[model samples]
Target: MKCKTIVGLFLMSTLAVFSQNASVVSPNKKISVELRNSANTQVGGWYLKVNYSNDGKISEVFQQITLGLDRADQSFSTALKYLKTSKPNLINEHYSVVHGKRVQCTNSANEVVVSFENQGKSKLNLIIRAYNDGVAFRYEFPEKGGTFVVNDELTTYCVADSTKRWLEKFNPANEGLYTSSKDGNLQQDWGYPALFNTPDKGCWYLIHEADLDKNYCGTKLSNVAEKSKYKLTFPDQWNGRGQGEVKPTITLPWKSPWRVVIIGSLSDIVESTLVDDVSTPSIISKTDWIKPGIASWNYWSSNHGTKDFKKVCEFADLAASMGWPYTLLDWEWDTMGNGGKLEDALKYIHSLGLKPLMWYNSGGNHTWVSSTPKDRMLTHENRVEEFTKLKKLGVAGVKIDFFESEKQSMIQYYLDILEDAAKFDMMVYFHGCLVPRGWARTYPHLMTYEGVRGAEWYNNGPEFTTTAPEHNTILPFTRNVVGAMDYTPVTFTNSQFPHITSYGHELALSVVFESGIQHMADRPEGYQDLPDAAKTFLKEVPNAWDNTKLLDGYPGKDVIIARSKGNAWYIGGISAERFPKNKTLSFNFLPENVKYKLTLISDGEHDKKLVTEYMVVEKSSVVKVRLLGRGGFVACLKPIL
Candidate 1:
């Protein structure tokens, strides 16, 4: 990490009735955050305002910012005394990741810390950082060696009521559809990573949090929002079956998670690494054991195949045939039959040179599921015992599922699992869980999370058949904007329920969705029946990307994205409309004056088949393509030597 002092500290008299304000701008000077000590603290204490600059003109993106906290004894929300503001520090650092939208990332921002004293003379600090792509802030306690229970957080984001927004209704599992709204008048509770498009501002921003640890509980935007002001609302008391307190109890010298608002153009929102940039860096120094790859998942197809050892071996064979690295053994592997026992299945999987990822149910009163391998990951001792055993059994990772609560204890449970899994050098994928808030950066082995309404929903009901096409198009801008999402992309065959999306659309998901361990949710036969070109593309496509580019399109209507790995680039486009959509591929993002081989895969005459074409291309080349209604396409570019 590198830092430079940009401005000297300005001290203020520690007076009870003082008026003071401070401001910090991004390195590029395109965004600024202003904090003011309100004269009338009763209404609120230390309000904030965020502004964006365009062509030397300034405009407010967030109308108002509310900050405060209520402790068991003291209230930091209002009637506070003002202290000095720290010097502006330029944070210019670069970090690399194991697997993400990009391999290289930047953490550049200008930060300021403002101190204050509550009515009881207790000290509080507000730390704010302004980045070119967004702004973030968090509260800190300067005192040391004490414990306190925070009854409430008075922080809030005041978006204009007229602003267009895409918000998902709140659910413990964080699995729900994002509904488009003209304003914030719909649901009182909405999930994090909400999307907004400021009217006439040409700016797009996503609201979320980063660096969430065991000390803090996950939060959501509550319609407690008056005048379109969305306040931070804690998880329900019933969370974790009423296990732990919703409010956080913390030791002194602690800081709250960074509340982030990523702002910029659509491309900036899609490609920005601000979430991970602000998160804690990787704790694991040796990450070569944490390999990212495509996994052949059995649940989406068989759902109960782990009980049948023969069926499990078939999928293992399928993975070996596809040249993939891992095979996920879903629930009920404890009751295996046919091909001997769990040990025999592991022997067969290892014989095929593939690492196996086993599944576990996060047991407790929190979830109602009756799956086996339950109660094995709830406590620290249990996780240590189980992870140690799995490590001895040659398991590469664990897909712990059914964690449907977000209370403080549950948050701690999630982190405990990640930390313990790392001790065994095993990767992790969280299912039936909250959306990732940059945990991957903190724990590199924390590969992916299933917090979206993914393909598994197709087997749950009929709604997904009709809703999935539109849902697929909206995710890149909404759910996927925050972190790695495990949507389990690309399935051509139907399970207990059928999908109406075209074969090409299914193929496009391999490139459209970004997951450290991208699970191919199809039967072995489904992949084997594909054309040679399509099969070759699947065999070579990468789950981890070097860079990502949002080429064109809109949410719910259509989308086109290009991702690169080494000298090869992969492009994906999907359409939700009922009619064919035409798009022109632009190669301008490629290396200048470089020739390449282009392999294009598009929807066939019908939904069941796909057609592949080959061509020569370069940086200046433009190719026109069409997608069938409720369909999609995938293309690959390899720089010709």
Candidate 2:
């Protein structure tokens, strides 16, 4: 009788452990995922199997992700229960479209929300949001308010064999050269949102995060655990100043940021709203004062022969002459040699009809000590007073720089500044920071952020070679797809370094790259030498666009894009191949009923010249572009009256 009683209890426990598994598919039936448990095995946890349809054919199987985490040294992976009630059409039930900062935003997908709990002495609950575009899941602590330490995420993503990846060689800083590698041959820990191309299956995948607010530490993929699987890893310690292997300490009832996996073609990857869809909504209810536009920056040209208030004002005057909205005073303006008083510079810039933007160091000059309670200018005690003084002094915005760490405190600082700047009706730009994970939706006062290896590196002769044309071509695919990239385009003449690209290549970048403030990099003297038609094009280039279309893009090779603002259509093409590439461009993408005027900016007959040709063309017109030696081309089609 004792043996029978024990056997009955064991049988019931076994059934409960593995009984709560489920499978879900996208409404369009293109993407699907299945969740199951392996509590009986050595590596016990919940896992996922994903399948994506490619070219109307289902690709090879992608497998398993251990969907769990350890909190305060307790495991939350086994002996789980699935409370199966879910919201499958969360997108449709909510709104379908939203206004965006860079591109047209859409949320017309479906979702499957499943809840789970670990049945241990110290318990935890989780909610998983599976979407057609991607998957976004987070942990929800049940406590009303308390602290919990997250040990690590037990997530693993396995790719198809022989896949090529366009990921950065990882350093503590994301400022590394991106390279192409095979699944079996990775060079280093990759950057966030690693882009992988599966040519055999004709599909692509992007791994990244969203809604990283309220002090959450960012994550990257770990080194390979097998031939094709990579686990989640945390950022390394910098200066012994942050939560080193320990993830953020959560004040509870806390929900973690979304872990997203976007799967599709390169075009779908570029147009994915997975970032914005998962982000928090606007916190500032009255955001009518927020504005995004070009600003004149003197950093790229600060050390060119002279550095002073007079020279600084020259750039401001030029921007005002072009009718640009702002003039951003870049680094070291507070103490640069011969750069006169800050008040005088602001007074002079405002007199020229240019709104003046000043710069501040988040970490207080060159000290490695982190920017927080110690940074006097930005301290909790003094920040409001300083910003109020700037507001009264007629300063338009502030470009804060060097957020050198990705700790929870640094992330909180970003939100803190955004919130404060909004209160004063002032906008901001972030430098040396993480890429946008849809923070713009929450804080419209945040104009742009520089997380890319931008043109500013050209000031150092060796770095001119580093920021290659190929790097520019890859950005529109990997970095710019997620958010605004302050690449600071259009430097006509190279000063301290050798400019390897042709004139047309620089011209096309104005169209290819996306930014709220499209600061032109060259001095006014450079623009003084441009042809009349080229000057007109440069003026129109800074306007915000209503839409963007990626026509042709190959990783680290070439790309062609079409962007529209109002009635004008701007087409830009760039080639980074060793030899010249010639391609035919069709105007059929234009509206049929309207007549148009086309302005083509292409390579000139001589190596040192750029030629612009203007003409009227029909929708059927097809033009050829001969791109040579890291060269490029641009076309502006304006509707006829």
TM-score of each: 0.95, 0.90
lDDT digits (tens) for residues 1-641 of candidate 1: 12223221222232322333477889988888877656643224778888888687766788678889888878988776767678888999999999999999999999989888886778899999999999999999889888988899989888886688888889988889989888776858889889988876567889999998878889999875474888898899876667777788888888999999998878888998999999998888999999999999898988888999989999999999999999999999999998588999999999999999999998988888979989999888998999889999999999999887887788888998888888999899999999988999999999999999999998899899999999999999988878889998899989877888999999999999999999998999999999998898899999999999999978888889899999999999998998987889999999888899999999888888789899999988999988888899999999889
Question: Which residue pairs in candidate 1 have backbone atoms (N, alpha carbon, C) closer than 3 angstroms, thus clashing?
Answer: none
The local lDDT score (0 to 100) that residue 316 gets in candidate 1 is 94
Give the per-residue lDDT of model 2 (tens digit) for 1-641.
99999998998775554333355666566777766667543224677777788568875435777677777756777656555535455465332222232345555455555566566544455455556666666666665866777777777777766888888765543666677777656634677767887757477888787888865677777765665777776666652244343377777777777777787777777766677777786687876666667777777866631247777778887788667888877765665346566788888887787788777767543236443323534565566887898899998787777766666766777788888888888888887777887787777677778888888778756765545788988988888877777888878777667677777888888888887777888888777688877777887764466777777888789888888877888988887876777878887778887788989988775434788878887788888888877888888998999
Model 1 compared with the native: what TM-score? 0.95
In model 1, the Cα lDDT at residue 129 comes to 98
Alpha carbon lDDT at 456, candidate 2: 78
**Model 2: lowest-lDDT 10 consecutive positions:** 93-102
| Local error of candidate 2 at residue 199 (angstroms) | 4.8
Candidates' lDDT values, in order?
0.88, 0.71
